[model samples]
Target chain A: MNIISFLNILLPFGYAVAVYAYGKAFFADTPWAKSSKRWILLSVIGTHIVYLAARTTAFSHPPATTVYEVLTLLAFTTSAAYYVIESRTGNRETGYFILNIPFFFQLVSSLFIKDLLEVPEILRSNYFGFHVTAALAGYSAITLSAVYGFLYLMLYHEIKQTRFGAVYRKLPSLENLERMSVMAIWLAFFFLAAAMLAGVVWLPQAFSDFSYADPKLIGTVFIWLLYGAALAARRSTRWKGRKMMIVAISGFVISIFSLTAVNMLLSGFHRFN
Target chain B: MNLLCLSISHHTAPVEVRERLWLSPEEIVKTLPETLRLGCSEAVLFSTCNRTELYAVTDGRLPHESLIRELIKQKNAGSVVHESHFSVYRGPEAAGHLFRVASGIESMVLGDVQILMQVKEGYQLAVNAGTAGFFLHHLFPSAFHTGKRSRTETTIGTGAVSVGYAAVELAERIFENLRKKTALVIGAGETAKLTAKHLRGKNIGSLTITNRTQNRADQLARVLECSTIPFDRFRESLADADIVIASVRVDTHILTADDVARALEHRHTGALFLVDIGVPRNIDPAAGKLENVFLYDIDTLTAMVDENVHKRRAQIPAVERIVADELHSLELWHASLQSTPTIQALTAMMETIRKGEVEKNINRFGEKDRELVELVTKRIVNKILHTPIAYMRNGHDAGPTERLLSVNVIRRIFGLDHDNAKRDDDA
Candidate 1:
């Protein structure tokens, strides 16, 4: 197999190994878990970069050209975001909970992922690349927010019920979890806002078929407004705590619906061939 | 292989019997010199409430009985301690036992990390008495290294082992950092005081103690250096506290569902950890149903503590692996003691011969050529010695007798004298 194909086959296993290592570190307290888990994750991200680069060079199109390639990019960006947050916060206890997302994304993408050496002229535009990168970054941040929100809710219930299990002992404090969730939401909002702006300015000039009322565009903008309002409400002291986490998690679900529903069920220019 | 251990531990003896052999650090220092006189070249005495073990490397005799008798005599418990109370380990097994002890695998509490420091102090005491050397110097440090490896490499020391600690552990799980959270302890009883003390030890932001008996509450607050709230008005301050510990002796629930709901609404905080360690139930069971209120009674806390203890027990094999790994390395080094002197002599004699031959030939060459010749000859010698040195350092897991025979065979083949081996070491 070519390097791109080889990495495509190898990518999911890399994440799976990272997932196992993080699990062992958090749950079983294995020796190699803590010292090497972060490096394992970083190596996977590095390998993924090589895979994306190889695919772009071989197929002569950026990774943003196909749904499968976009999934891999999403996986890459999500893990990279988690790594940055972990390094900055020095809170690695929640890595096990957070890593499952990228693992699932990469696993599915690797299975059905294709190599595209050539694409339509519009797909080659730098504007489309920036737009897709921004959108992927935003989606990755939302994934992180959802994971942290889910951990917060788990820890929240564990405490409320006085169940001092692994979730209770290994997770960060509720305040910290809530803070991280909000931070991810804020990041998602900014990236998505930029993606939408790029789309609005570049779409009409690039695609005669593009419409303002297209389902994917409208759904994405709608998801953006949903989080934007959540952040604004929290800023104004109207929403916080368990309720805010629920909203962030709900936002991820709706975004997933938009990604799948608008791309699969609805007819839209976002379903580029 | 000369190493030996005479141990009287809780596993082999009753507490009454074990305590008789206990020695203060000073007493251990005093007794260490006597151990060298017991046919041992080096000695270390480790004495605690759970165990009293004398580890020594004898020059010729085992003297396990004599060491036991001396320890019993030192404690004036000759009538109490019997031969059955002592477990003896010899050679690598002796090193392995000490490794287990240092790593807390042999501790009464499974992974008692405090035993590591105690073992460290025992080594220091032996050093102070000037009875620790060579084997012990390596052995004790290896034990310390084993202890460190076991702690860092396993989950043996991670969980809470007691109910009071478990309560605090639950709180820690909720609030990532307890330094900024306030604690409100209801009642000035011992349970309340202990839980309060644990909270204070963790450096909680503030503490407010309340009790029906105002005088008792004031006394406890003064002792703990915290403020006191009136028993009735304590409910008003509940919203300010992130952790509420209820150990008050009361007939009914001190905190009902309504009280918790109002607190959660008023606090504007994320969560509240309420630990009820009272004899009779103090906090309402219904309060645990509240969204942000976490209520843990004594039984639940005990259950969590039990689970943590089980987790620690499950880590025994992991710690044992560390002990085994360290013991193997120590045994290799100990085995080297047998063959190192011979290898050193061979290298020294070869160097002497090389220097002699170089001096004889130096007049035939210029300065640059002579230096080059010396370098080439040295490299040649090292290449020739590589196999022998590697074998002597670590070729296999050689027993003492095997190692002795190997070293003797090497010495005979190299024409190396035992005394000639000491020159380089002494230098």
Candidate 2:
């Protein structure tokens, strides 16, 4: 393989190593391991950025039209999102679980990259690029929220059952996990809203005979309403902590199912080549 | 040089005996010089609630037991202490014990963070008193480094082990920020006071202390620099309080389900955490079942502390590895002290012989030629001495005994005696 493809293949492994380091730091309490994990993650992001740039130049459009390219973009956005959150919160303990999403996506994308095909002319617009980027960012944020929710429930059950195992000791406090989940949900809601707005504004101009009944559009709108309702419920004090965590986790699961069904099986304008 | 440690800790002595051996700051100042006068080459007196250890470096003339007895007698004045109350460790074991103590492995609560600071303070006090000499100057910093490594490299100091600390940790878990929360301590008991102290240390927004007796509440409030409410009126403040620590001792429950329900009604929008550390369960258990009300009693807090303690205990092997690594370096430094003088004497003797032989051959050469010949001969002599000197300094990774035997063989081969070795040390 050429240099860019070689680095692309290695990126997933680098993320795997970073995730492993985070786990070691969490369980072994090795301070240097956390720092090493961070640096390795940053290097992987740098290499991924270079690879994306190379692909964009080679394809004469943004690298968001093919299934593998979209998957790669999602992985990069999720990891970047996680890195930002980790830097802000100084909470590296949850990184092992949160990073697995990006690592898996990148691994699958790299393995199936040879199957990528040419995109239709209509799918190569800047508006479509913005729409895909915004959607990927929102999905990554939802994934992060789901991971935080998972950690919250795990710690909550551990505390309630008095297990006090490795999860109990290593994870952040329940309140912290709840707060982080809420924060990620808020980001997800904002980005999904922006993605929907972009798609709504661009569809009529690009297609000239736009239909609102597209499955991807309906799915995106449904996911948006779900998170929006979850955020609204959070404003009322009763639907907080555990209730909000469930909402975030369920929203993520529905979004993933919707995205997969729309991309793989449904006949839609948003389908990748 | 003999390193010795005489310690009386919670493990070795009861509170009564430990109290007798406890040295206050003033007592340390007064008695530390007396310890030096009693023929200790160097001394550091470390005293905390859990342990009191006096680490000394001394000449072999003074008996370790008698010296410790004299130092204790001088410090305690008329108090009688049995010899069995104190445990003595000498040489490498003494260094190891000090390292373990600094690393908090030997604490009553495993992996306490306070002992390291206490160790540092003890070393500083010894330095201030002009009692910490070369050995302690090396040992104390090494112990501190080991303590830092143990804390960072292992999970030893990761969690809260005390009930009061666990209560604070729970409060943190329930609330997003302690700075925005108010704590209501429901008794003037010690546990309540400690709980309040821990809350204050976390910089909680405000604190309210309540007791059946108004004066006791006021006393505690004054100490904690917070306001006090009449015992009957504490439930009114509970609506504003984010955390309620009920440590009161009473027959009936101080906070019932109805009371908590009323408080929750007033709270309206946030979580209310209740920690009942009292023996009789100050907060009703049913109150914990209420929405947005998190109640934890002493058993729960104790379980958390026990879990944390277990986690820290599991890190003992990792910490021990760090201690072993530090001890190895320290022993190497100590061994070099043994081998240094012999190495110096051997180098001096070789230089002397080389210079004497060079002078006998120098008369045949001119002045400039003599200078060149001297430089060449000096370089040759140094190159010849380099291998043996390096071997003497660092070849043996064995204990001091074997290293001492090796040094003795080198001394005999070089015809170096104690006087010549002393001269080399002075040089």
Candidate 3:
């Protein structure tokens, strides 16, 4: 029996089980449910490691070519980001749902994208790899921020209706959610700035276009500007609580569309290859 | 139940009542026995500056007023009991109230921690007294677990909210090296003590404690490894102090802007951190506006606490889900207890009947030995209970007849009565 084939299938199956276990520990009323959640998280991380390793062996490159590779990478980075944040705060379970969202996107991408697509010669440069990797990491981090933003919105909505306000009691407090979102955004902003800079540095020599006038590039810059404004507002203690969350979410939404829909429709460097 | 929550809390009563009801360690030991003898099955008394609650679980199921009256009478006979400042809850309501209290839901600041551990300690005291029985044991543990789950699942306890913590955070934000700074804490009140403790934890050196009650100041100094100054010499010590936390409730200002300016003249240009936790503003507000002097009042800390409360309030759903899940698990176990005995008794009766029938059949084999007889009996019993046990184990025994017969059918069909066997399962 070939070990590589077995692991490729097993890892995704493990991810599914991990996701199910997460749901169980989060929702089910049992004695050792917490322990179960810890185990599930460990399993996901473990399986993801194996999955990445196998894909590396098969493709002979860092996993970021097709939609499947991008989705998996995105999910892994998102989950990893949340894991660090949650561990720091001792909120191991609140981030579980946020972490699993990428898995859904990955599963869909895996089903559609054919395996072993040939890499374009133009995309073979080291700058291409660096730019793509950084951008994906930035997007993943922003995705986590968006998750927190959604949680804040949900909490805000619930508090408005007195009867449904009980669930708000279960989440991290509004300030904590805001902080989590801001942290994610700021971290992503750093990576995004680096990625944009790398792309700019690569453009004149690699693509002969010095200006980042491409729709995807412009959209990313807009996101960067929006987040920079948010950071400045946060420092001044003005655009913090709810307003900050809404802006962060809107910026992330634009980034998402720019990277996916806009990239597909209009010509851009990063697209669903 | 005898649940008297005689509390001089931030709610129901003021700080004056709390101070009056506050019992020292010696007073607690003296009052415990009397409190217990007054029909209180268990008593856990908490006397903090924010609240002083006497949570007692008792065997009496009378009205809340009667319970309170009884508790007051019992406690009054031994020590002075302030009946006007008491609140009472009974049974489930009392349990739920305590749970909420421990969970920080009923806190004046809404999600201010420090109550849960106090509640745990109170429960432990009751346990140590051998007064905690079924209800108190289950209830207290549940309360503690709920509190743990709430903090773990949410960000209810985040941010530097308390005045002491805010002071530390601000200090760290400024100089970052508290080890070199001299922190002088004024007053021997709870706030001052807490602030000193926070400062001490940060490795601040050269602590100078000065209180109106010099002995109290001396005691605090000894405990915190700080130097105690006479209250009259406080102004003299302020010249070299890097950080001053004024926590006394003085009618008039202790450190005016002029005194602060003079102190600034004497002190280095590094920084002067002043935290005024006193309600009447121990340090002049204008003192903070001075060059190289940062001042914060009790309101600044209160605002931080409010903001944290807002954050924790948002985490309510996550905490609630955890509590609700645990409660459901408890209910499932409770339901399992209701049906388990019936299932066991029914299975046992079937085995007994099977053995009897096997013996009767073995009589036909008069020449057979005891080995054959035992083997045949085992086979027959297994055959009889196999289907029903399987169904019950698989959670498929759905019919009313099965439910009724599981308890009664085995008895009627096999002539198994209470005299044959007695149930050993109490739960």
Taken over the whole model, the C-alpha lDDT of each candidate is: 0.85, 0.84, 0.69
Which predicted model would earn the best lDDT? 1
Poorest 10 consecutive residues of model 1 chain A by lDDT?
A232-241
TM-scores of the candidates in the order shown: 0.76, 0.90, 0.46
DockQ, candidate 3, comes to: 0.03
TM-score of 3: 0.46
lDDT, candidate 2, A1-273, per-residue tens: 777678777888988988888878887866678668888888888888898888777676787877888889999999988887877777767888888888898999988875234767876688888888999999999999999998888877666555667787678877778878888888888899999899889888898657799887888889889888878876764577777888989988989888887768977666666
Compared with the true structure, the alpha-carbon lDDT of candidate 1 equals 0.85
Whole-model lDDT, model 3: 0.69
Positional deviation of B134 in candidate 3, in angstroms? 18
Ranking by DockQ: 1, 2, 3
Per-candidate fnat, comma-separated: 0.61, 0.30, 0.00
DockQ of each two-chain model: 0.38, 0.35, 0.03
Per-residue alpha-carbon lDDT of candidate 2 for residues B93-121, written as tens digits (9 for 90 to 100): 99999999989999988998999999999
What does candidate 3's lDDT look like per residue over A208-246, in tens digits? Answer: 544567888888999999899888866764455567888
- Where model 1 places Cα greater than 4 Å from the true spot, the runs are A1-34, A47-62, A93-123, A154-177, A204-214, A232-241, A266-273, B1-43, B46-97, B152-155, B187-190, B197-232, B314-427
- Candidate 3 per-residue C-alpha lDDT over B28-89 given as tens digits, one digit per residue, 9 for 90 to 100: 55556666676677766655567656667666653445544554553353244455666666
